[model samples]
Target: MTKHMTRKQLNSRVVDEIDRNLRQAFDDMAQQPVPDRFTDLLAQLKAAEDKKNSGGQQDA
Candidate 1:
């Protein structure tokens, strides 16, 4: 037996499949932990800002 889908039906099915897969991937990523590298980078940024502020105060 052969089944044929019309253009609209085929497009809807493809869209539904893509939406389902994207939702699943987002749910999986939400459970993961934050990495240490990100924290270290934030700390480095804070240190650089503090140094810049101190230098500006000396110049004034």
Candidate 2:
């Protein structure tokens, strides 16, 4: 027996598969940890901002 899908049905299946693949890729990326270099850079930026906010102090 041969089964034929309607045009709409084929489109729906294609959309579903694309959605599943994208979700899986996002989930895999979300599981990864942030790198230490970026963490350090962010911390340094925050410290600079804090110093600037306290008073525009010029470093000697």
lDDT of 2 by residue, 1-60 (tens): 449998999999999999999999999999999999999999999998898899976785
Predicted candidate 1 versus true structure: per-residue lDDT over 1-60, tens digit per residue: 459998999999999999999999998998788789998999988987898888853442
Which residues of candidate 1, in runs, are more than 4 Å off? 1-4, 56-60
Which prediction has the highest lDDT against the true structure?
2
| TM per candidate | 0.59, 0.81
Model 2 regions more than 4 Å off: none
Compute the lDDT for candidate 1.
Answer: 0.87
Instruction: Give lDDT for model 2.
Output: 0.94
Which candidate achieves the best TM-score against the true structure? Answer: 2
What's the C-alpha lDDT at position 41 in model 2? 99
lDDT of 1 at 5: 90
What Cα-based lDDT does every candidate model obtain?
A: 0.87, 0.94
